[model samples]
Target: MSDATRLVAISPLHSPKSPHLPYNRFLFSSFRFVSNFSNCLKIKHTWSLKPLNQQGSIPISSVDSSSPVSIDLKPILNEPQFDRLIHQAQQLHESLVVLWMANWCRKCIYLKPKLEKLAANYHPRVKFYCIDVNNVPYQLVVRAGVTKMPTIQLWKDGNKQAEVVGGHKAYLVANEVREMIDHEDQP
Candidate 1:
């Protein structure tokens, strides 16, 4: 026989009753190893992926949780509260950040907490309030010129100073908000 034929004859894959047959122990063991390795990779990938909202996933801003710098943002429940807060901020010469949002808006939900956290840095200087456009009257929303779901407006002396239309990603919106706060002294 030729060298090629001799090699094929000695190979278990080419044999009718070889130990490496398709349904034999050796083939089964190889398949089991591959399957187990694939499952292990899947498990390892799952463990490595961390969720954004999970505890310890986000770093705390400061070591002291009870510091005066911590800001507690509350939603404006009604038109009366909205009017009152605006008037109060104007009287106190403090800046007011009014977030025009809708409950059904996914972007609004994600951006709200981030804005609240951002408000902490300007605590006592700026106050943040969330207003669900769905819950509030149509006239109030119209007055604010909120044509979008997550429109963030900086109000001072009962007038709109700077507005951020959150039609983009959360991070970009947050950056724009920070820029607005940073340049708040500009006309």
Candidate 2:
């Protein structure tokens, strides 16, 4: 078994804890401290769980990857606010691409930049967005049949167009999206 699995077996989160290791004690203390701080600050500080790519937040799409083209996967716009985005895209007759990602997923981490670059370069024509899978409801994921992180789904005129799963080369996704846009323009 893997070292991680063995350690997990020894200290299962679902089971009763042992006082032998300092890990649990540290965790409990940290949790308690955070909880107390959160409660105290709850009234004074208003916390919004927006995505990482907000105005002042770190840009998720500027991350370095092993690929040639660097992408920026930051939420160039705002929160999920899908309906508003859909309305805008429909009004402009532009195709929209939504990226579903998780903060902890390594593949998603790697693909973020590429996605962002696509959004930047393709802006005003092919609209792009990044949605944290953690923030979005499970029903949305299940309804969209999103079985993997770093998934990209395309939409046009409020209708589902296509979807790409897993991390893909930036150029390939851009090409596919451009084709979709072109195909859409044909009479």
Candidate 3:
């Protein structure tokens, strides 16, 4: 051994009341959370975890519900757009399903998605569009002779061939709209 080295002896087993213990759990205990409301000592550690997903309000889309076809409507923002689209469909020798809807109308809102799905069945052959009645000029609405909230019209060759006023249940309205489309299609 080097001169600097010091010999150490192993201590015997610690007695129950040993002055030098390895650890004191009480000395390193966690602090209790304090509440802002009062200075009273809380018996339990009061803690909470906020839910990751909260339940509230009407959902924009249905859960676990999906459309196989995933069809959508092309919106006509103005009268000029409406005229151009109708003319285009006429020139191409194809039909257009125009849904005349208003934001405030609950029936219009309900029937729209059903019609969109209906559009999927006629995909590529007949195009589908939506015109918010409020967005277009009143004069154009008068010219089209639309007097109701939800009007589903089938147009071909720059003319409205068939129409269904959808003021009833969505399913019935969808059926009427479908029948109109099918009826207009036949020679």
Candidate 4:
């Protein structure tokens, strides 16, 4: 057989015996030799380029720092801010949407920005807040009955009225949240 063919055939045998110390040492040395040999060879390549359109212009940051920017849409991060938001919503009779999330959760990270954009539509009518499960007190999370990350709950009169466990796609979760808000009056 050719050298390459023999190498391919030996791969399966080597993998099965990888737990053996002697076999592992041999495999490590062989891999290092192959890697070093491969690194000695080099290839040349060329790239095609396109020029920029000089007529196109970019906008500069003209925003005033002194003026209070639009209602800071960032999610509430602390207990005091959370309590104050809930109290204000209760007093105003507005619906409150709290997103129970965790920093390490990929789904939660992706879902958060989408939810924030959605909040803009219901501005002044619905309030949105985010709680990182890792940052907050354990008792608070326990009280909410949050067994999973990215749990979206709608609160009315300081009570949880509806919940959307975001285990599915972002679009589906957004649709569910919208439906929940639309059908808030129903049981």
Whole-model Cα lDDT per candidate?
0.68, 0.57, 0.71, 0.65
Ranking by TM-score: 1, 3, 4, 2
For each candidate in turn, the TM-score is 0.64, 0.51, 0.63, 0.59
* True-structure lDDT of candidate 1: 0.68
Instruction: Tally clashes: model 4.
Output: 0
In angstroms, give how far residue 94 of model 2 lies from its true place: 1.7
Query: How should the candidates be ordered by lDDT, best one leading?
Result: 3, 1, 4, 2
Per-residue CA lDDT of model 1 for 1-187, tens digit only, reads 2211111111112243444332111111111112244334211111111112213232323232432322445788888888999899889998998889998999998897678667866776888888999888998999889999799999998888999999999878978998998888897
Stretches off by above 4 angstroms in model 3 are 1-68
lDDT by residue for model 4 (1-187), tens: 2222112111212442344422111111121112225345232332221221212121243222322111223566667777787787789899988899998999998887568657765776888788888887877888878999789999888788999999989878978998999898898
After superposing candidate 2, which stretches have Cα over 4 Å from the reference? 1-80, 167-187
Encode model 3's per-residue lDDT on 1-187: one tens digit a residue. Answer: 2222222232322342445532111122233433434444343322221111112222334343222232568888988888999889988999999899999999998998678668777888889999899998998889888999799888999999988898789989988987887888587
Question: Among these predicted structures, which one has the highest TM-score?
Answer: 1
Model 2 TM-score (2 dp): 0.51
Q: How many residue pairs collide in each prediction?
A: 0, 8, 0, 0
lDDT of each residue in 1-187, candidate 2, tens digit only: 2211111111212222334422111111111112234334222222121123323233434443232222334453333567677878889888888888888988777676556655655655677778887877776677667888777888888877777776566557656655655576554
Deviation of model 3 at 159, angstroms: 0.3
RMSDs, each prediction?
Answer: 18.4, 16.0, 23.7, 16.2
Give candidate 4 regions above 4 Å deviation.
Answer: 1-73
